[model samples]
Target: MSRASPAERDERLDPVRWHRPTRGTTLRLISVAVLLLTAAAVLWFKPATCTPLLTAPGPTASSTGKAAPQSSTQNQARDQTEGKPAARAIPSGSVGVPIRLADPTALSVVRPGNRVDLLRLESDKDRTTPVANAALVLEVTGADDPVLGGLLLALAPEEAKQAIATTGRGFAIVIRPS
Candidate 1:
């Protein structure tokens, strides 16, 4: 046969192929499938939930003076099985005191069930004094108002008086560790 030009030789040598997908297309499909599987795994997986180690004490049956009486045999069985003395009932009567924070942004770090120490700020003397220690945070109010964020603290009657008294002089809260 006569020698053909390079362009003509390339055209004749090229094979007549059907519309087959390229390697890049196959790789793209595999990548999409892997991404979908990863998403499904993320959505389907669930973490185990555990109860708190130190939960607040529940209301005591002894408080109402209506606890069921157990026979001596039953009491002995319970004592042996439990291997511990009965816990004393927790005393209740906590008073709520509404105390304002000097910096409302500080309340963002405080949560209900958290304990705080209250302090009184003396503007005239430029001194800070402790008002109450380890006061329970009962409620956080005025959350919508950045400047009016107030705290409702659960305290003993005397402690409540002390916290409320410091409201006029301006108050600050110190978040305590659990």
Candidate 2:
């Protein structure tokens, strides 16, 4: 029945200087470290080319069965090589087509010259199908009116036809890299 000396007391009694990690705690720490390292490695290393999840269709023959003209850049390069006075290059393949967006907020995001993919909401479940692939965003009208708040797009003739036909259905725009 006497108090023990400080030096004779067990170190476990000194709560501040002791740490005992449970198995679950150690496993959790290891798992977190592994996850962090894996994330870092994935961020640091990337593939040379990123593959597109869905392929977009380019301008094809128009509804009239006439094939579309080549893009300006290609024509300019050809003209330069052929030694013809670079004819005033014209944008011929795509034409402006108007389509309303189901979501009004979507109108603010699109701008002229931005490449976009058009999708149609197919069912009540929100499933979608790509209607126009890699079409150029020609213009966006900043109107909140449900029917008027939409975008004007420069799409191939076939895509224009598809877009015109798909207007009644729900439309969603997906912006793409130029």
Candidate 3:
């Protein structure tokens, strides 16, 4: 081995260089980075090993009686009213009733299947009193007062018992023109 020279190749001690790190090489690089982060947190919280690219199957009402496939983006924001389509906005002996809106900007054009009336108000101001005439807006919640909002309503059963006995004495949501 007599031909290596440029001053022994720049004072070589190279075994692919990186060496000053020890405490047993930082405990074997922190045990291979905690065993690759506990195997990526057990495959990222296990229990879901596949099979779900559009799973709609759990509503068996008795395994095979049939009836489960309504999703045209929920009838494309329904509201044909007399043409009856937003999946009958809760009409099957209805009784949902949540209502709390007294005007939180009319729950931003209330949706989920329009058709409403609700009124009742009168808490120290302009009188109004109808409490459920049309009612069917099946869900529009979001009210910590970013302009008031909350109205589940599906009524009928004596208008869900007069809108659940006048839901805490306050109401107001008129939208009925469609």
Q: What tens-digit string does per-residue lDDT give for candidate 3 at 65-127? A: 776643334343443444433433355567677777655777767776788888878766678
Of candidate 1, the 10-residue stretch with the lowest lDDT total is 83-92
Best-fitting candidate, scored by lDDT? 1
Off by over 4 Å in 2: 1-90, 143-147
Candidate 3: Cα lDDT at 138: 70
Candidate 2 lDDT at 66 equals 88
Candidates in order have lDDT scores of 0.70, 0.68, 0.67
**Model 3 segments more than 4 A misplaced:** 1-10, 13-15, 18-21, 42-95, 98-100, 105-126, 130-141, 151-156, 161-178
Cand. 2 Cα-lDDT: 0.68
Candidate 2 worst ten-residue window by lDDT? 49-58
Put the candidates in lDDT order, highest first. 1, 2, 3
Q: Residue-wise lDDT of candidate 1 within 29-122, one digit each (tens)? A: 9999999999999999876653332223453344468754322344334544795322211125666678888878887777666889988888
Tens-digit lDDT track of model 2 for 1-178: 9988777876445647756999999999999999999999999998975423222234556669987643445544565699542332213676778777767677766666678899987755658878898876655665445455677777788887877776345788888976
Error of 3 at 65 (Å): 23
RMSD of each: 13.8, 18.1, 13.4
Q: Which candidate is the best by TM-score?
A: 1
Which ten residues in a row are the worst by lDDT in model 3?
Answer: 51-60
